[model samples]
Target: MFTRKQFVSASVGALVAGTLGACSSNGSNGGSAATKASDDSYTLVQSGKILGASDLQYPPLSQMNESTGQPEGFEIDLLAALAEKMGLESGWIDPIKFDAIIPLIQQGGKADVGLSAFTITDERLKQVDFTDSYLDSNQGLVVKKELTDDAEAYLNQAGRKVAAQSGTTGESWAKENLPNAELVPLDDAIQAMTGVSTGLYDGCVADLPVVSNLTLNSYTDLTVAKQIPTGEQYGIAVSKDNPGLTKALNKALTEIQGDGTLDELKTKWFGSNI
Candidate 1:
């Protein structure tokens, strides 16, 4: 339907085919809620639920609840709300590697959708279909609270060690903007922030909502020095084999967006709508 929009050929999709939902969200796992959704419009990984694939470490977006040992965050809550709209229950999140989500979706036995903070692009479109864009996103700079010069300028020089999550747009942004800096690509965005907190790096680049949540709460010593507007939007990665699911999800997403559920979630988790 949306033929001329975003990823697969350039840096984003190709870089993220290894990144978003491949189908493995439906790849080879089985974890669903107790009550099965009775919807019959689309096929699902689990009969009554919408199973998901995730990295499970990024907080406020999607992460494992320390006490519950299950996934929680804006994405998780949004997923439940969307599933309910579709007459289904929210399924459990299967912990998958960051770069392996899309491939797993392609494999067809794991989960129903990939629930990570996936920035939909034409490159990723070549691999898996995406539902309508849910959240507008941008790159963020996380730095130690003590060093507060022009955030971008101070870090745009040689010898400034900056950490970025590998295979994410944040890495690409750092490469293009902080050309002279020593960019360290970590396994995930949170790791990049942790590396900075431990004094291993001067700063880190990652998604805005994620870094914003961390700096405001858990990592109090850190601060969001800058928010780089990348004009990126996050989407749910569904299987190409499951177009029905995509449409169904889009409908539900529209409902939430119209009803202000999305805005409320943003305010609850990120301290304000971003």
Candidate 2:
């Protein structure tokens, strides 16, 4: 039997193959970002318990840090802001794989919503509904600084070994754009960068901020080579059946952006008003 890790790496790629589209634009709130879908004509469930889940990897958005040894990143802060707006007390479950979040909601109704930095894609849309975009995340490739000039050449190469966080949009982008390349999925950006450092993978594909975080501090040797037109957007996800949950969250998300609360949080964490 394939282990969960191997199965996730192998089958999930096949499961999501060839079904990505341009990500939606960020919301006015600047606190959250998502696809610009026609608003769901559903009602927010008055039931009070809202569950939040995120993969405990990928820094500046969601990752473990040396200074805190706990999960602290942009997404967590953003979600906290979202929760404050809704007056909803959220119950957080950690270490869930990105792919499993939708299923957990669909099957168990385990979470009222998901709070990970999940990208919006049509393939995922079939499984769960998404709120308006809260962030704009362009796709990018990170490699050793020396290979900056050879990025386009590398993308054109066959079997280029690229690393990504398991079940992330980065992994999905690699499957769509570089199908011929060997996509090596790690658990987090730290490991992804480590793979590049150890010569285990030629490069990594991830959101611009993740690549930025990697290069800005620890991974000095790594640099972003090419920016792919992923037009990626991140949003909160809920079961399509939960129209009520979706509506309330979307409203809350919108208010955050409209009132500049989102911008405040963005500046606090990111240093530039997003």
Candidate 3:
């Protein structure tokens, strides 16, 4: 899981909209034979492409490259590889609101799959099916330098304002674990981190990897105060209407894991940190 500070500007959004419009047009006319699957065991929103939906606001996991107006990250690479393994084109990745992805997939005819860093939980299983676990992660707390080092004590302090990304596990964890603390839900992790950096919030909660990345690379003034090991596992979500697709994804994931491809990817992205 990860989050970046930049959002799609109006011009960038227009560019993306134009690109997707072209994709839709070409998809109707068989853009590429590679995207067309000879076998009909599974369904796809687009015939010749695996349509993937992601927020594209998360870094390392997924983020938009402003220069190309396209997404690039570990999850994007993995999804491309998965598409290749399934005998489809590189795949059409559409940037969407993170929380809207699940609902769109469940409603059908939008995307073939959701490739964000979605943690597998019992509550989510009721809405959509998930493939085998890919990444294991946990929640983390980030705060300014002056806060007490004792995370528990800091959280217990009255009137402490904490921030978390809306609709994320971090938000839920903060609400449950720091009931007395004021909870501020923001659109993305960057906003939460910004809140902490500007003293708008006492601290912020987010995925451990995200907090670490932001602190190390972008928000140097901030630090990871504590790590909350929630034992979260990320997975690819498939529509409940497409069990066959889920099975196919699991098979591909197993093959990749067994062949060391997954390890190579982890090493490439996480380096010595893994």
Decide which is better by lDDT, 2 or 3. Answer: 3
For model 1, the local distance difference test gives 0.78
User: What ranking of all candidate models by lDDT puts the best one first?
Assistant: 1, 3, 2
Question: In lDDT terms, how accurate is model 2?
Answer: 0.69
Best by lDDT: 1
Span of ten consecutive residues with least summed lDDT in model 3: 1-10
- For candidate 1, the C-alpha RMSD (Å) to the true structure equals 10.9
Candidate 2 segments whose C-alpha is farther than 4 A from its true place: 1-49, 65-69, 155-159
Question: Per-candidate RMSD vs. true structure?
Answer: 10.9, 14.3, 10.8
TM-score of 2: 0.76
After TM-score superposition, the amount by which residue 6's alpha carbon in candidate 2 deviates from its true location, in angstroms, is 46
**Model 2: how far residue 30 lies from native, Å:** 32
* Local lDDT at 263 for model 1: 94
lDDT by residue (tens digit), candidate 1, 1-274: 1111111123246335675332212212443222212221345666557888889778899888889887888888999999877767887655877778988876666788887889998888899999888889888898999876688888888889999877788998999999999999777877888888999999999998888888887889999988898999999999786676788889889989999998998887787887
How displaced is residue 49 in candidate 1, in Å?
1.0
